[model samples]
Target: MSLVKAGQLDYLNELFSRYSKRIYNYFLKSTLERAESDDLTQELFIRVMKYRNSYKEGHSVQFWIFQIARNMIKDHFRKMKIHKDQFNLVEVIPEREDVGDDELFEREKKLHRAMKELSDEKRELLVLSKFQGMKYEQIAKMRDTTVSNIKVQVHRTIKELKEAYFQLEEV
Candidate 1:
């Protein structure tokens, strides 16, 4: 990133190659739209270049990139006037479970449905922590909150997810 920030345009390739797919997956999970995710991913890199001067030295590059991604997602939802309850979290189960394929698929479906029931804020937190594999400390800094607060919120969110999951089972 410093290399890119130093007006060496060629180094942008390294940054793109390193972060593109992970950032793209973040967009995909947040928006749940493949085409939009692609467009957003491309746009994000453009912004990074356009705002390369804003990159602070000695900071985590990953954090800076995700801060941009998070802002873009907020802008997207803002422009669309998207309601919190309307978003759907499509997949929640891991692949390659020891359980039979049919059983795994069923579990995935139920979890997916339960995830959709989460508010957008809760869903985004879960996606960042669980799906994107971002550490709680990173998420805390990203959200401008304390790590303990993020952990408590995550714990409550998990509890909510489990409750929702079991309710689906009873249905």
Candidate 2:
């Protein structure tokens, strides 16, 4: 890791190469805007570099990176308050013409809307676990919470999502 401190460009590039897609997807799922997600992803890496010295050598790099990504997302929302904006939900979700299964697409859209109705904490956990494919232990470690707590939260959040989803369906 000394290579990172010595301003080794290749080391930083390697780190970015390994994690960029994960980081971008994390932000993308939250922001739902390609350009904003890209910008936040770049900023997350920059923040990672700025705080590199603080990272313990034995720690999981993925968790550390995700923790940073989580904070960056929170700060982004706090600064812009974009969630309050009025917009067409259908338009906000980008169309994927490659998804030929109409039923699957509609289900996904309903799920997304259900996800959006959840509280921020619930939504973050859902995005990290479901969209980012993070295990509960990994999420707990990153969030500095217990695995059981994370599991419970995830369970409750899923229940909440189901209720909201059905309510929307009935309308």
For every candidate, C-alpha RMSD to the true structure in Å: 3.5, 2.9
**Whole-model lDDT values for every prediction:** 0.84, 0.79
Segments in model 1 whose C-alpha atoms lie over 4 Å from true places: 82-106
TM-score of 2: 0.81
Clashes of each: 0, 0
Error of 2 at 151 (Å): 1.2
Compared with the true structure, what per-residue lDDT tens digits does model 1 show for residues 1-171?
998999999999999999997898787766665666788999999999999999999999999999999999888768545564554334534464644588777877787788777766787788899988999999999999999999999999999999999999998
Q: After best superposition, candidate 2 residue 95: deviation in angstroms? A: 4.3
Candidate 1: pairs in clash: none
Give per-residue lDDT, candidate 1, residue 11: 93
Candidate 2 lDDT over 9-66, as tens digits, reads 5798889999998788777767555777878998988987898887777777888888
Worst 10-residue stretch by lDDT in candidate 2?
A: 86-95
